[model samples]
Target: MSDKRVPSMTPPNKAYPREELEEMMQKWLAANVEAEKAGDWPTYLGPMYTEDAVYSWNIGPNEDFVAEGRSEICDIALGFQMHGFEEWEYPYHDIIIDEKRGTVIGFWKQLAPYRRKDGSRFEIAGIGGSWFEYAGNYQWHWQRDFFDFGNAKDCFFQLAGAGALEPVVKKKIHQQAKGALLPGHRKLREEPSRWEKARNAMAMVKIAMTGR
Candidate 1:
């Protein structure tokens, strides 16, 4: 991994009003719908982030991804990370917005572009969600995603076993298995885990219940 540091999650210098945030989030969602329809995530979704925005997600216990700045977020995160998933469907099921905090959470599912032998869609077995920190002007300053890594792995294995995995995706999987670090990825200990917030919340709940 490069010695380059991840950007800090500093609060914006100014707070956006609740009304403005609500409107901005709605506009963002509408634009996202168009982007998904067009199948051009980098072109449509990249511009909707602040110049210095950060986007991150956890792959598993040993690795995590972090793309700092809009350029990396677009080229690497949105572009390269989606190489084999171009035709896949990731429809959002629900969205929750916190106007006061200027944040939004979107729940979605990962479905293969093609159906299985049984005539059913091949879907990952767990729900995926993203937490976005709104930056005024219908843009996001930060984003962190949550999902079941194990379920994703299992789904890919199932696809491979069924001879449904794409050639490019198989290559990607082999490359990743070789231990070469992909761009924007770091060892878990080097970069903060994306699950930190969730784990903290769980800890809080446990403490509250047990008075520990």
Candidate 2:
């Protein structure tokens, strides 16, 4: 397989000390929460990346979403996903630090405050993680995320079908389904294997939940 890795444009002169790295991460996480809450994406989130940072994620085995440079990362990759999720909480459940490699892996969940049929808040039940390559100066040179698209689709469908989605969000979803690419993002085409994998996983979860 061809190497998918992209070298960092602004490689750090030296790896950050473990304690300093940990402290920086803590501050970053806290700032992220506040940013999300305040809807201050440009001020709070944009500064976390290097000017030449690359952000990417796999849709499955074949398709990938990639955004090169901090502008694309903020305006496209991050902006597209958070379009209507202003109220959603993305709390990291775990973080693995690699001081030697200047990398960190964070496992987080997307949670919505909307009540489900069972009176519980809605949360996508699946794995969600991000890998960050930290450049010096408290900025990231690269980031990639992985998650179960099946669960995300299912949750959104449930909300939309039930008329629980905000009107703006519903409109956005419809637009996306109708082939409107997010700003600074390329055309997104799905692979058969990716669709099948997502569908199968969702089906298994539904069967387990309802014993069907």
Candidate 3:
């Protein structure tokens, strides 16, 4: 496709139309969503984001979790494109448009295989809430905090997808075992001790299975 600028730069359309803006934002979302689901982010990162883009996994590993610029951002996700994704998630994205500032509020989630080749799946999940700031040229300028997954499978997906989770995620299952008995909040029960142990074991297995 042409890298040519749009007509709005001049005056044929005057200002950026709301519909056009939403569509453009949708395309960015589409790019991210597709890349995330298909497990290839290079396409989205290249054609869909700006050079100075920011990536924040909310406080990161240390105070060093935040990355500025496209290169830095890629450093965070490149490994995932290599060793992760396929063995992992159900990446979900919910977008909200802010026409005034030209931004999108993206709610994302990573979930365990709801179905697998061996016929195994989780009955619970969690969702994350994050936001993306646009650079006005159909690219992202910044990405900020979103909530943690509320269920086991979701966080597990995040841990696997990130490829850097030193502490594996089996908390969701434990939490479910302990909490959530109501209708709207009904979830699988996961006790503290059980989950911690199972998760630790899982962590060891994951580490041994994949040297990633």
Please write out the lDDT profile of model 2 over residues 1-212, one tens digit for every residue: 22344344343545678887798689789888887888656568788899998887765454467778988778877676566777888899999988877888899998886887789888888999888888878888888888898898898888877777877788776786795644444433443577898999999999999989
Off by over 4 Å in 3: 1-16, 59-64, 78-82, 87-93, 114-120, 149-212
What TM-scores do the predictions have? 0.81, 0.77, 0.52
Q: For model 1, which pairs clash?
A: none
Runs in model 2 deviating more than 4 A are 1-14, 60-62, 184-212
lDDT of 3 at 7: 15
Supply candidate 2's per-residue lDDT for 33: 88
lDDT of each: 0.81, 0.77, 0.51
Error of 2 at 11 (Å): 10
Give a tens-digit lDDT track for model 1, residues 111-207.
8976777898888878798988887777899999888898998988888988888888888888888977887888756544669878988999999
Q: Tell me which of candidates 1 and 2 scores higher on lDDT.
A: 1
Q: Comparing 1 and 3 by lDDT, which wins? A: 1
In lDDT terms, how accurate is model 1?
Answer: 0.81
Better of 1 and 3 by TM-score: 1
Report the poorest 10 consecutive residues by lDDT, candidate 3.
4-13
Candidate with maximal lDDT: 1
Give the per-residue lDDT of model 3 (tens digit) for 127-160.
5665666566666666664554245435456445
lDDT of model 1 at residue 82?
82
Please identify which of the two predictions, 1 or 2, would achieve the higher TM-score against the true structure. 1
